[model samples]
Target: MLRHVLEVLDFLDSPTADGPGTIGILERFLGDLDPSTSELRPLLETQRVVGDRGGTDFVTVTVPGRRGRMADGEAPTLGIIGRLGGIGARPEVVGFVSDGDGAAAALAAAASLLRMWRRGDRLEGDVIVSTHVCPDAPTLAHDPVPFMDSPVDVATMNWYEVRPEMDAVISIDTTKGNHLINHRGIALSPPVKQGYILPLPDDLLRIQEIVTGGPAVTFPLTTQDITPYGNGLRHINSILQPATATDAPVVGLAITSAAVVPGSASGASHEVDIALAARLAVEVAKEFGAGTAVLYDAEEFAKVNDLYGSLAHLQTLDGARDESVLDSMEVN
Candidate 1:
């Protein structure tokens, strides 16, 4: 994991012209792992959706599982999204930035998975890795932490990265800026399937323990956290934004630390910690593709739906029409 992490860091720690956004170089790098198992495509025209925002280069890599994405008897495809604004918060900060951990970790997992496949350990289904590249991304001010602002908005990210072919997704992001999760490794969030906040499955907990060789833990989740962005509401971060555009089951993989680290901070990324997060994504992809890891119990989810009615409304940009009424306003 450490080796793969370093490889990815070295790869993405460069300008977009030479890094992950360049489909040719990235395609060549991935082809080295297993040409049969990896495929890359660069989406240069995505800037149109982002209103011609410069420094935005979107790319998606598909690492074939036992079967391809279109095979008749292929297993479910797993989507691993490196959810971040950019790898380097340039012009605002100096040197390579840790805010890019989401993209770095995501690319690392893709490489490792393909490497595993090359070692004759292919997964059951396909694994798709998608993220954008922008070394000089802008910054935004949020409470408790400052974050790397995206060159393109969240909707554009979902448009290019989130796909209907994905049945499950692991959205990884650097969560060191938040105070709620304090640790040195990774933590999982409850399954955000469709629009409902389903309970975290025990199978995932068991897998976490198995992978970390420690106790399983989860980050606290809220309804607002899972809801779509642009609803005039605050969220922890863009970690869960992928769930908005797809009906697939989604989980957030947070790379945490004991200290409240700002996303814009440089030389703050812990190689070991990022490696752990990447490994978690890799392991989940293996389990999920093999049909051995259940993110949530189907029967239980159905029972909750029957008893409580549909919660899919929460997936909308504006949730619960009555909640939008901010009527009782006064100045003291």
Candidate 2:
């Protein structure tokens, strides 16, 4: 995983990094797997979409498990989303920025999984990894530090990255632009289902402990953070954006820093930290797909909803009647 992380970082830490270039790197990595295992090769797909600011390349890699849906099996599919504004700020920042850590970690996890599959260490369910590549994304002003704004908006990102086939999602993002989490490695957010932020499951905690070789560290999430973008509210970042677009339970895997670091700041990515997050994601995918890990207690969630009514309204725009208005709203 560390090797893949370093490889991805080296590729993304360039002014020429773009979506097609990223796809090519991943293709070469997965293509190197033994040909005898070609029957289980992961599916790779990429698309280029233009927006007002610019365009980005959305890439998705589907690593089919032995019992995954793609293989006509019933095991659940896990989605690993690399949520980020861009890899490079280009003219503003000449190399890969801290914001690109999410993409690095995610793509690395995908590469490792493919290699594992080829080595006969396949998981029980499928894993879909998705993220976009934009080398020259714009930067946005914020309180503690500047943010790396996407060429496109959160809605467009969700539409391209979040898939219906994902039974659960692990949204990885570089959350270093704030003072909220004063830790250096990675931190996990509470499991979010629909509009409710459920308690973190013990299974995930164990996995974090195993991956980090230390006590589990978690970050806090506010109601505003989980809400959809363009709702006239301050969000911690785009870490939880995937939750607004899907009913499936989603947990944010944040790459953090001891001090606030601007998203567009180059030379801020830590390979060891990114590798740790990637390894955690890979372990979660393994247990979750094997039915050994649970994102949330469905029965407890239902009980809470029964007593307190629905918070699904929080998933929509404030004063908007439904989610249909999402696409119409302009995201800042």
Candidate 3:
């Protein structure tokens, strides 16, 4: 996993890095593993989309499991979304910024999974990994540090990265700009369902402990963080943005730091830290596909919903006036 993470970081930490080039690296990596058979080869797709700010390339890699829906089986699917504003705040920031950790970790996990499948270690369910590549994204000013802004809006990102086929999602992002989580390696957010923040699943904690060889570290989530991006409220980051678009239980895999680091700051990415998060994602994907891991307690969720009614309204832009309201926010 560390080797793959370093390889991905080498390619991403360049000014010429783009969607097609990054996809080429992944294809080459997978192709080198076993050039003979195409039986369990993952499906890789990339598309370039332009927006008012600029353009970005959305990449999605699907690693099918033995009993996955793609193979006419009943096993559930897991989605790993590398959520980030952009990979590089180029022209302003020289190389790959700290925010690019999500993309690097996600791509590395996909690479690792593909290698595992080719080596005959097939999982039981399908895994979909999605993220974008932008070498020249814009930057925005914030309180403690500046953020790497996206070429597109949050809605555009969710539309492309979040898939309806994902039964459960692990949204990975760099969450080091805040004072709340002071950990240095990685941390997990509690499972968030339709609108309620469910208790942290014990299965995930066990997985985290095994992956890091340390006690599980979790961050707290406010109702505002789970809400949509354009709702005129401050969010920790885009880690939970996928939750707003899907009813599936969503948890955040945060690559954290003990200090407040600006997302737009270059030379802040830690390879080992990013690899740790990637390993965690891979382990979760393995268990989730086999139905051995649970994202949330369905019985508890139902009971709470029955008692408190639906809080799904928190997932929407109820108070905002219209689409133009999104422009008012700084957009982390």
- For all predicted structures, in order, the TM-scores are 0.87, 0.94, 0.94
Off by over 4 Å in 3: 32-40, 319-332
Candidate 3 has a TM-score of 0.94
Better of 1 and 3 by TM-score: 3
Q: Which has the better lDDT: candidate 1, or candidate 3?
A: 3
After superposition, the stretches of candidate 2 with alpha carbons farther than 4 Å from their true spots are 32-40, 318-332
Q: Judged by TM-score relative to the true structure, which candidate is superior, 1 or 2? A: 2
Tell how far residue 261 is off in model 1, in angstroms.
0.9
- True-vs-predicted CA distance for residue 161, candidate 2, Å: 0.4
Model 1: worst 10 consecutive residues (lDDT sum): 323-332
Q: Write the per-residue lDDT of candidate 3 for residues 1-115, one digit (tens) a residue.
A: 9999999999998888888888898886666554675565689898887867888888999999999988889989999999999889879889999999999999999999888
Give per-residue CA lDDT, model 1, range 268-307, as digits (tens): 8888888888888888888888888876678887888789
Predicted candidate 2 versus true structure: per-residue lDDT over 164-271, tens digit per residue? 999999999999988789999999999998899999999999999999999999999999999988878999999999998888999999999999999999988899
Error of 1 at 268 (Å): 1.0
Local distance difference test values of all predictions, in order: 0.76, 0.89, 0.89
- Evaluate model 3: give its lDDT: 0.89
